[model samples]
Target: MKFLIDAQLPVRLSYLLKSMGHDAIHTKELALKNATPDTEINAISIREQRIVITKDSDFWDSFYVNQEPYKLLLVTTGNISNKELESLFIKNLGQVVDLLEQHSLIEMSRDSVIVHQ
Candidate 1:
């Protein structure tokens, strides 16, 4: 799976995803870097068919209303350190991928993963 890590997420998450054999890129790597606008991010995801992994609710709203971004992983494990966020992601990523096969929107928290159509 291809993934685009949003600015709110650690850049290391992109490397982790790559290490797991997925093609992934962080916003910081792009020309806009961390300042990339949501519209641009949504455009890139559509162009590349990348799954957007973000903590931003804007993407969630857009996905539900516009059905853009191709796919989404909305991280809801609020107020955690980057290390903890990465760890939680690493622990649950496999399930996330599995669920994404059938669901376009996925809400991932520290305790559970919920799939939304």
Candidate 2:
């Protein structure tokens, strides 16, 4: 899967995703950097067929209401350190991918990964 990592996430998360053979880009890599607006991110996701991985609830609202992005992986483990956050993704990403293959939305917390279709 292709992923667009959000501003709040560590850029290393993108690197880890890539190492796992998925294409991934962090917001800091974009022209607008971390300041890239949500709408623009959504647009890029749609254009590139990228699954957005974010902690932003606004994307959740946008997906529920507009359904513009092709896919979503919501990270709900609040305020974790970068290392812990990366570890969470590393531990749960397989489940995440499985769920993503079968659903449009997946919400991942520290202890669980839930699918929302």
Q: Which tens-of-lDDT digit does each residue in 1-117 have in candidate 2?
A: 899999988999999999999999999999999999999999999999999999999999999999967799988988899889888888988989888888988999999998888
TM-score of each: 0.96, 0.96
How does each model score on lDDT?
A: 0.93, 0.92
After superposition, the stretches of candidate 1 with alpha carbons farther than 4 Å from their true spots are: none
Q: Worst lDDT window (10 residues) for model 1?
A: 81-90
Off by over 4 Å in 2: none
Task: Give the clashing residue pairs of candidate 1, or none.
Answer: none
Q: Which pairs of residues have clashing backbones in candidate 2? A: none
User: Which candidate number would show the highest lDDT if scored against the true structure?
Assistant: 1
